[model samples]
Structures are given as C-alpha cells and as structure tokens.
Target: MTMIAVCALWGMLFSVLLAEPVQAADLIRALMFQEAQRVLITSGRGLVRQFPDGAEQVMTTPVVVTQLDGGMTLNGARAASDMVKVRGRDDDLIITVAETPVSDQPQDRLSDKVSDAAGSAVPPAELGPPPMGALRGPAPLHTLVLAGAVQVIRRGKSLMVINEVDLEEYVKGVVPSEMSSGWHLEALKAQAVAARTYALYQRMMNAGRDYDVVAGVQDQVYRGRRGVDERVQQAVEATRGVVLMHQNAPVFAAFSSTAAGPTEDAINVWSKDLPYLKGVECPFDANSPYYRWRAELSLQDLENNLRRQGIAVGTIASVTPFSFSRAGRVGRLRILHSEGELILRGTDFRRVVGYTAVRSTQFEVQSVGRTIVLAGRGSGHAVGLCQWGAKELAELGYSFAVILTYYFPGTEFNNTRFGAQAPSSTP
Candidate 1:
C-alpha cells in the first residue's frame, strides 16, 4: 500500500481499538457516576403527549407544563385535577385521554384579600402558609408536574430550578434553618448546578455502562474534591420546574453536602511572591478544568508525603463549601482560589519536571474575604486532566488526538460515539 493509504488505515485501526470497552473492574476503579438531574429532553413533546389523561394542559406555548396539584380554596376555590400537558397551537391539539377528576384543595382565596380606602389590592410576602381551606385537598401526583413550575417566582435576577427534587427540599427545609446563613440561595444554586451537571454527564456517558470513567477522570483531576463547571450550570437550568422530593416536600441543595459546611466569614486571596506572577498571566475563570488539575497534583503530593510520615492524611477532596478565586505572579503560573483559601498554587518552573524543594525564597497564602475560601496552587488539581495544559499543548499545534492523550494519559476518546443505550452488565 502507498504511504498515505497506510497512514489512513493505521489511524482507522487505532480509533477502533480506542473505542473498545475496557475491563469492567478497571473501568469501575477509574469511573465516577452521579444521579441525573436537570435533564434536557430534546424529544419531550412526544413524552408529554404520551401521558394518559386529559389532565395535561398547555397553559402557555411550546413551553409545555402540567399541574401537579389543584387550586387553593380559601373562599371556596375548588381543587383542580392534577394533569400534565404539552403546549400546542390554539386549536390543533387533539388530546385523546379522559379528563381526571379534580382533587381541589379547599382554599378561602378571598378571605385574605381586603380592599383599602384607595381600593388597591396587595399580596403579603408572609401570607403565612396557604389557609387550611386552601390546602383542603392534595392534587394527584402527575398534576404536580405543572403546578410546581408555575408556583416558582423569580428571585433577584435568576429563576430557581424548582423542578430538581433535591434542591426543592433544600429550599423548603434547609433554607429556613439558614444552613449556610443568608447566602443559602446563592450557595445552594451553585451547588445544585454543579451536582445536576455532574449527574447528567454521568448519565449520558454511562447510559449502559458499568461505570463513567470520564467522571472518574474528573474526580482524579480534583483528587476527589467537588469540581464545578459550565456543564453543571446548564443542567441546573434545563431541569427547572421539576420538583425535587425530599421527605415529600420541595427544597434546595448544594452540589455536594460536604462542600457546604458551616457558614464561614470572608477570606482574602494573597500573592506568594512580591511580583508573584513573574512570567505567567492570571487566568479568567477559576472553575475551568485547567486549574483543577493543578490542585489534584499538589494534594496528591501532600497525601503521599503525609502517608510516608505515617500520618493518616486523606486525599484533598474538592466540592467542600467554598467560593472561588484565582492567583499567581505576572511571569509565574496562575492558580485557582476558593473563598480566599488557596485550593491550588502554581509551583516554580523547576517543579513541573518532578523536581522538589522550594526554589522560591518566599511562599505565602493570601485571603480575599468570602463566605467560603479556597486556597492552594499549581492551578488545577495536578492529576490526569490538565485542560489548560492540554490547551497549551493544543496551541503547540498538536492534534486533538495528542491533546486528549496527554491530558487523559492512559485513556482514549472514542472516535465512534456510542448510541444512547444502556450497556448490558456482566454480572
């Protein structure tokens, strides 16, 4: 065969080999999995249409919804049937399911309303819980699917992902207790997003597999700490309006409960060197995977050395309750910070090639006051996935193939994307 033909064949063969499933045991050790949340259903129209019962109603447009419960009855508003429905054009929908009887909650809707001298009506922030008459009856399980969505109000600028079962519980139960102080909403939202994204990614990658190695790659990347990313944000929003059932009520929750510990005071992020960043430029996004890798490595080294000293030092786990930040001198490497806590600090150049000992004459930690702090360095957890490093490698004009290989090290990205099917297990 000609040189070009041989090369093409070699590439094809290599791609196929990479796609083969690794040993289940090995895969399990390397993979991480989480529950699916904030799922974005592309074919949801059909799924909604499949619900049996005329209970589903399209209150709005293509943004289909369904009532999970019935109307309140303070002055006698009867409970309505719980239903689910997809939005359709004004008259084209031809629903075939029989309508379910309404399980209206008896509510005195008018009892709370009183007209002032000016005849202006107002709503109270603490109307207290809906009157007993209002909650006279509970709606069907399915109907809640929609009612829950409508009840969610806009807080500040963003809408809460009310549909998430876990977060709903946090909002209802945890928030009242001030689990993390007045910043519950902001902190929980961040966690929920991170959790939802991590969950969805796991589901997508492990649809039918024994494990999700990519997640494991990430876990290793963070040295087993909570790692948040853009994907988490996407999942949190996409699954909005879905009610999370925690002990039978809605609430908010964080990405990792452990990550949201006692409310902390502010933190300060400081520079190690006077001209700390001697050669490296500061990074923009601290949550990016790049810094995460640096963190993993530093912690790993810490753990190993600690073990040698016969100390029971645990691995540096991510996702602890902490805000985010960044650091580094102008010419040195940059790093990510959390709540003034240096989660990752860049090492002097000589360290990258496995050299140890402080080359720098000075090293210190700085805090930038935040509720939760993250301090440490290198950039990301020094692990299997160094995304920025990969990018730099990519910029070296390396092929995507080489980039993934270097970052992932031992693993390979499947050239043939797998179908969304559950993989059969070898029990």
Candidate 2:
C-alpha cells in the first residue's frame, strides 16, 4: 500500500481501539441446555427486535421473565402461544407478538430508577445495588448459548434486554472486549481485575434495572463467548475474585487505551475526588499511536455539528481553547459564533464535535482558512489506569499488582466474590 493508505489504516485501527468505552445494548438468542444456577441479567434493551434462530426454525415461543422476589413474580410471561417483539413508543413501551398488540404498560409508566443497599443514590465513585436485586443465571459451570432464551422487557417507552450468564463467564467476555488479547499477561491480568470491578460496579449502579452493563463500550465492551480470547481467559482466571479496593469499596477504576503523559486525576475529568485516581507520571505509553496525532474539521462542519447537538452557536466565527486541565487536556473551550460567544467544557465539546476527532484533552488548537485543526496527544478520559502504560510496564517485568498500583495509588487487592461490597474507608 502507498504511504498515505498505510497511514490511513493505522489511524483507523487506532481510532477503533481507542474508541475506549462503548456502552451498547443488543441480543440474538438465549438457549438453556442446563439447569440455571441463579445468575440473572436483563437480556436486551432499547428499540430491539428478536427472532428465533438456529433450531427454532422460524417458530415463535412465549417468553417468561419473572421477578426474583418472594412469590417470584413473573414480570413478563407471554401467553403460552404467542411470540412478542417489543418496541419503544414515545414515553411508553409496546409488546407486539401477534397481529394485535397487548398493552402491558404499567400504570405508572415510570422509568426504572434504582438505589443501593442503602436507599440513597450511590456516589459516582461508588457502585450501588439495584432496587430490584440481581437475576439468577443458567447453570453455574456451563457455558450459556446466549442466543437462545433472548426476551425483551419494558422500562417505560424504553425496551431493554440482557444476557443472563454466570458472573465469571461475563468477566471472561470482558477481558478481550476491553483490551487486545496479545498484550503481556500481567497487563491482561490488570485489565481483568479492572473489568471485573467495573462490571460489578455497573451491576450495582443499574440495580433493579433490566441489565447491568451494555454489550458496547459505554460500560466496557463485552462480546459474550465470541469475544473471549484464550490468553484473556487465562488472565481472568488468574485474577478471579481479585478486585481493586479503596476504603472497602470498588474504585471507579476508569481507564484509557493510552495516557500520552502523566495520568490525570479523576476530579479533573468527572468532578469525583477519588483518592486513588490521582494523576501520576506515566512515561510508558509513548508507543501508542495516539501518543501524537492530528485532526481537522472545516468551519462549516464545526458549526453544523454544534447545531446538530442542539447548541445554537450561530455561524461559527472562531473557536478557542478556554482552559486546560493539569493533565494538559482542554478543560474548557470557547466558541465564537455569529450570535455570541459560548463556553463549553472540553469533554462536552468532544462529544458534540465527535470524540475521535478531539481524541484527547491534551491538544493544540489552530485555524487555517475556514478549517480548524486539533493536534492532540493521548486518547480517552485521562483517569485511572492506562492500558498501554500497563502493557509497557508488564513488558519490563512488572506484575499485574505492580502495574495496577503504579496507575491507581493507595489501592490494595482484595479477594472477593460477585456482588460483594465492604464498608467505606479512607486511604
């Protein structure tokens, strides 16, 4: 390939890998060949369509979704003879099985709001259990054919589904989903711990909801069995039940593919003053493609993007960096529109303009003609662990514990099981 073509491919892969967290939701099936071992997960979510595949042979079957509470209320059990497809309609949900529709709308039609073991909303830094509790999964030691037994449920007008798999199996899928399997074993082990911690954290945050985490980057990408890698599986197994703990609770454990330089404190990114999420020098990820990169967008596209996100910044005349974080990432940006000047946080601007376009907060902004250029370093929200840095350290013989400690200070490994939480403690 030509130099330009090779460069383009490199950039594309960098962007895809650095896409970081993808909080997506979907499904294909859920077949149970063994007895369930009480691991429950909300199987699907949001404007989703499900059909019988494999041996079902175009046949439709009624789905049974029951609340695990005493008397085990069957939340959604279709009539034995109907196959239903759920749809989100304006502020309500609709289940369509046959030609006619069964309006199984709750009288309240309220959204699924939840809290933790305590009745209060868990702090952003901590995970809270769902009000409805967790759903049991199929057979403890068996691999679930998630494509079967797939069903849909309603949370107001939002329809959601989830894959109910064993907690350990779910962690296995996360190992490869969050990071490449080819990295050093120590780095992969660190990722496993982070993934497991975050998975359970999401579960708590989404308690009483249909599913804990999505299948995309939003919560940490998970591919079920398909995404699992043998090396990644070993990493997950090695670190089984091992979690990073701070004051007896799982830390937020935010991570990025690369930290161009020193990691940034979580407070700078999310306003969460986490003790362990403090920024530290990381000269290890210099090898990341995103360690240095550039992107440019025409003035017209910039203004159009703002409008698309409902930001009325009339015609864009100029864009300026309003502020910078301690990590050198843009903390705030000023937009000079024809109507007036507006200020927006760097993070929000990244979301509106396109995350991959901005890449990282550490960047220089310049303009040439009618186009704006952002030459930046690093990728992802600069907080918590740095994946590339971990890999580099591991290459130099650093174990997972050492790698995790280097990124997240004041944290210690705590061996525990699923859904476990300890009392809060200060480092």
Candidate 3:
C-alpha cells in the first residue's frame, strides 16, 4: 500500500481502538528539544521522512540534523528546507545526544536554571535522571526511545524537535516519569488521571502555539517509552480517557512530590485562584525524604544569583521571612544588602536560588556567619495533588477516585472527549 493509504488505515484502526471518534485535539505535541543546534535520530526498524511539500522517503540509516544559515543540513548535506517530520516505520524513534558532565566543585554547585510554573523539581524515584541534553559538546551519547513522530523545525538559526504522539501514549510516558511504577496501584491510577488532565489542559491553553506540552520538569516529565512497565500500562488503561473536570472543563491538575504540611493554595503560589486548588490539611507525607531538610548557601553565591536574575543587590547582609501564607509557608522575604533592602516573593526566592536548593517556600531562614541555612518542609510548590501523600493514602487502602477528590476538591471526573475544552478563565 502507498504511504497515504497506510496512514489512513492506521488512523481508522486507532479510532477503532479508542472506541470513540478521534478529533484533532486527541494528539499531544510535546516539545522534546527547543532551539537545539544538533540532534541524532534513527530507528531500528527503518524510518520514514516526510517533507513539507507532501513527499515521503524511507531510510534505514541514522540521520544527523543540524541547523544551517537559513535552512538545515541532513548528515552535513543541505536539505534546502526549514522543516522535516520523521517517524519510525514500525519501531520507536531513538534520539541520541551527548551528556554534559556535572561540576564537582562545591562553589560551582549553584544552578541558575529555574523551574516552570508548577515548581516541581523532584526527580522520579524509579527513573533516575531524565535523558536530558541538547548536545552542546562531545561526550557519551545518551539515547531516548520515543514512540511518536518528531518534527524538526528550524526557526532562524536553531532547530526545534517536537514529538507528536497519541494522547494516551503521552500519558503512559508521563506516568512512570513522574511517579514510580512500583507504588500502590491506586496511586499510579491517580497519577495517570492527573497527567492526562494536565496534558489536555495545557493543550487547550496552548492551542495557538506550535506545541502543547514540554517533555520535562517545566511541564510534566515525559521520557517516552523508557520507564513504562506493565503496572504503568495498567494504570493508564484503567483510567483511560478520564480527567478531572471543573465546571465542564479540565482543571490545571497540578501535582508535586510532597506536601509536608498542608497543601498550598494556588492563589498564594501562582496568584491564580482556582476553587478546586484550596489548601487542605495533609499529614500523610511525613515518610517522604524531603519532608524536613536543610539547605545552606553562601551569602556571596546568593547575591550573585540574585544579581544574575537582574535583582540589584550589593552584598547580602541578612535574609528574613517577611510574611507567611495562610498555610504557614513563607510568602515573602526581606533581604538586607549593602545597597539597601529588597522584598522578594517566596516563589521568586526559590527561582533565584535553585528549586532543588530551597525545595519549598515553607521554610525557616537562619543567617549563620557567611552562609544562609534554610530548614524547610515539603518538596515542590505544594500545590494541588501531593504524590507522596497519595502514596500514603493508597497504602492505607484509599481508592484512586477518593485520593483525587481529596486533593482536587470540588472537581468531578469526565471523559477527555467531553470535558477537554478550555475554561472560561485561564488558571
């Protein structure tokens, strides 16, 4: 059969498997690499490349994609075009990149990178570190097995790699990447639903953009088919096409590692008040490793980080909690510096200091000598569902439905086909 005929047949088969009519929104465009200069892509079972002008070709060897002056180069040969789409013939697409080495010096430990809107920085327990790199320097190659078609689009001087995959398959990639598959079956189910809802919500919000969600901590960690196991598959299938709905639309459905104390209010964290994201007493996550931890950073380093973010500060003299939220998490901080004083929001403070360093805003600050010591509870921003809390609840025999309702109060379950519309107000 021709490629067009085969693609039409596959579409019909996919719709039949779904047991529902497929729509344009049923697919998720996940941003895998943004503005990357180079990437290595191949497939074990042959590959198919589609051009912008509706042409296709089959390849059996690996292809290196690099940005050019105007267009791009395929294996050092110019393609004369700015965009290309590639997919595996019958196997998963493998993307490879060289890994950057981590610095060993203590002074170089501070990372200026900031977390996304959700402020989730905790790594998945089962899937160690994500296969994350844009390939800047030469090093050991790290391979990522992805189950979707990748679009390589060149914008100006750099190239972007986006994975366009089925919504259900996207959720499967997210479940094991966010939470461990070995956890209670109920917790995994809850995570599956949340991941699905969050993805749909993002798709709705980003309809005007090129992609829906990013495959990283910025959005939800999606490692394609890397960590998917039987349990993860079961969890996804059990709650297939289900999402948390609020007023006939999917909620933001934010989640985090641990809410050591009470879950936070979205109004306090992101300044967007959703009726379902109210704070609630959460005492089930004490077993979490990040429940209570201490992070110390030198005053000089803090000042440097603050300056890097365009916050003018001469030398940090003292850092004190200026205000507290209703959940008792720090709301703002008063920094005394050589120049003067600056009031920084707790969320901005977490951004200035690495998310991994400060962990959460529910912390006590102590300026001892030349270092600032922070004793904090919780991981992530403490908004919406708490994964560790859900684990404990699942262990205590709570059903996934009950766990989801407990975290996202006043939210109802709805099929993705019906309730995946954009809300009247963006969260």
Candidate 4:
C-alpha cells in the first residue's frame, strides 16, 4: 500500500481507539528539540545510557551528543547508531539536556530537511523555539531539566530530542506554564484537566508520529518540573485524569489567555467544528493584560515577512477586513498589492505578522497609510476555555467543573484510572 493508504488505515484504527477510555498510566512523548545541532546530556544522580542494541552503560560524567556524518558522537566517541536513550540512575529519572543550541540553518531550509527526514511537511516555525510564550525569543543558552527518559534521535544532519514522561507529570508541568500558578486553585484545576485532555487527544491522533506533542505554544507550554509548585501539584492531583469528554472521546480542549469578548468557535480558528467548541458569552476576562491592545505594522515589513514565508506578493496598497466570524473577529482580509489583490485568512495574517504583534483576529484596522495601525482585544485563538475567564469564575466561588462546563458546553468529566478521583459533580 502507498503512504496515503497507510495513513488512512491508521486514522481508521485510531478513530476506533478514541472511544476507549485513556489510562492515567499512559506515557506521553513530548518533543523538546527539533533539528538541534548539539546537546549536553546528564543526570543529577548519575546517568544510565541505553544504546540502540539494548546494551546499557552507566556514566558519571556529562555526555556531549553531536550529530555526526553517519550517526552521532557521544562525548567525542562515535556511536554508529541513530538513537540513544538517557535516564537517571537510582532516582526519579530526571534527565537534563543543557546548553543545547538550535540548528543555525535558515527556517525554510531546516523545515525542508526535517520534512524530508520525517516523511511529512513540518512547518518552518515549529522546527525552532516557540514564537510566543515564556520560551519565546532567542536565548544564548537553552536548558531543559526534564523528568523521565530522554531520547536523542539523529535525523539527517541534525538531532531531535524527545521526552517520554508520565501523563500526570506532563500535565503537572503544563499547568503552571500555560497559566499562572498564583491564580485561584479552582482555575488551576480546570487548566490541569484541559491540558491532560489536549495531550491525550494529540497522542491519540498522532500515534504513528515520532512524538505526541511539542513542549511549546504549539501544544501547551510544558517546562517539565520548572514551574511546578505546591499549588500546581495540588491542582493536578485534585483533577487527576479528569478530561472533558464529548461522545465518549476527549474533546480537543483548546484554551487561550483571554477571550476579550466572547469565546471563539474552533471552526473559525482551526476549522474543527465540534459542537462543544462553539463560541459563548465570556465577558469575565476584561482585566486581562491582553484584553485591550494596539499595534503598528509597517507595510514594507509586512511584505517582507510574507515573501520570507514563500508568499509571492508585490508592494502593498491597502489591507482591509473582508469578512468577520460569528464572534465578530476578522475571518478573511483583503491585501491590495501593487501586483494584484491577495486575500488571506485572518489567522494566517497573524502568523505572518507575528503572534505577539497581532495578538488576535478581533482587531480593526485603524488606518492603512505606510504603516497599519490595529486596535484589538484578547490574546490567542480564543477557542474553547479562556484562562482569564476561568480565573474570574474561580474567584467568584465557582467550582472547576462548573468553569469547564460553562466554557465547553455539553462536555462532561471522564476520569482515566490515575490520580485522585474528581468530585461527583460540579458544586
């Protein structure tokens, strides 16, 4: 059979599998690094290195892994194999990858190489560090102190770092990174369930892929044990294995920082038109720092960014909102350039301009001179749950279950066999 046939077969199989309940003991494979040039791996307690041939060795010192012409070099020694696994010895399996510099290749070239190696077209931006969130921007050094086994796989001339962690532990790491740990406990609990469900959903969908989710804004921001604290632990434990279920399968459980006005429909953003992901009245997050914002974008820079992304365009003349979604956000935009008229999706425009610059599609073009001025509200795609709205609900004495149901209407809690059992119903 051809590749498409195989993918179709797997999709059918996973659709059947989705009906089955997920287990709390399930392991989550998260991608940490894509096309990294080099990485230093070590364990706080000693290191147990497992070779591809099933042989294991214990090393007390740090191991520098670099992509070699054939495979990889471990501490300057040639390892003919394409993969290696590292784990902590006699400890909680905390593996640390220190000072790993990302690939110096240009974004498009790196993405092409990865897509060729992985047998799929991966987005250029995803092959690098996250564009937004706590890990956004360039850093001189990147360190990941992760819990669980770490796999270093050589693909082409680069390496991909993957973390295999327990489901609950992964959720624990996500809770604080996606939302502030200082928020109310109820809000934290809601976030935990959402994060867990999203991970599980992605895992189920991408069972044939190398990893389930990316540890960044692409999925959920997961910093391993970095932001995990007492409150975060309590929240994860309280809602352990609880996920929002629609028709026996876990919903996508998408959430964003703020839903400045009303929560958005997933169809409008991701084209996934699930009943539970419909827009709803959400005026509770007005106090969000991103609830209101202004941005100025030079048309020249916009044209340059678009061309860099392989979009053919000429000098821009004007940009106007062509259509709006049900939530009153721009759905499509008309870009009048010197060459011709180019219409782009509002979401795609945000990606081209930069997520931080154009926070959301819910903005109006104030002016279109040499530069574009935008006044908008909210941050993120505005689908499913609103983090700020959850915070306000929790502060108003609402239970986590209530908060979830309010945002994701028609979804109920289903507990996988892990962590503490949730309450019988929303209080």
Which residue runs of candidate 4 sit more than 4 Å off their true CA positions? 1-24, 51-56, 92-139, 416-427
Worst 10 residues of 2 by lDDT: 105-114
- Which candidate do you rate higher for TM-score, 1 or 4? 4
Write one digit per residue (lDDT tens) for candidate 3, span 1-427: 8999986775565335334322335789998767567778899888899877778899767878988888899988998777778999998999875543121111101111212223233433222334655324454566778887888888788777888998889989988777778788989899988988898788867979989987766787777897788998999888878777776667889888788888889998777889999988888888777789899999999898988899889888899999999999999999998899999999889878877677789999887898989999988888888888888888887778878888888887764333222111111
Q: Judge candidate 3 at residue 22 and give its lDDT.
A: 26
Ranking of predictions according to TM-score = 3, 4, 2, 1
Candidate 1 wrongly placed segments (more than 4 Å): 1-201, 204-376, 380-384, 416-427
Report lDDT (CA) for all predictions: 0.25, 0.57, 0.76, 0.75
> What TM-score would every model get versus the actual structure?
0.24, 0.65, 0.83, 0.82
Off by over 4 Å in 2: 1-151, 156-159, 416-427
- Residues 120-223, candidate 1, lDDT per residue (tens digit)? 21111123221101222342221112111111112232111122123322122211111122221333233232232233334334547433222111221111
Candidate closest to the true structure, highest TM-score: 3
How do the residues 1-427 of candidate 2 rate in per-residue lDDT, one tens digit apiece?
8999986775565344323322223121211211121222223332333444522222222233332322222234333322233222111222211110011110100001111222221111123211112124221222222322344443332233444555566667666645667778988898887877666556545656555665443455454565565887799777766767665555677777677888888877778898898988888878776688799989899888888889887888888899888877788999888899999888777767765566677888899989988888877776888787877887877778877776778876664322212211111
Residue-by-residue lDDT tens digits, candidate 4, 1-427: 9999997886666446554444566899998777666777777688888876788999888777888887899889898677878877865444334323233221211011111122221232444543221133344456667788888889898788888888999999887666767788999898888888898889878979989988765576677787788998999988766777876667798887777888888888877889999998887887777789899999999999999999999999899999999999999999999899999999889878877677788999956669989999987788888887888888877888888888888887664343332222222
lDDT minimum window of 10 residues, candidate 1: 256-265
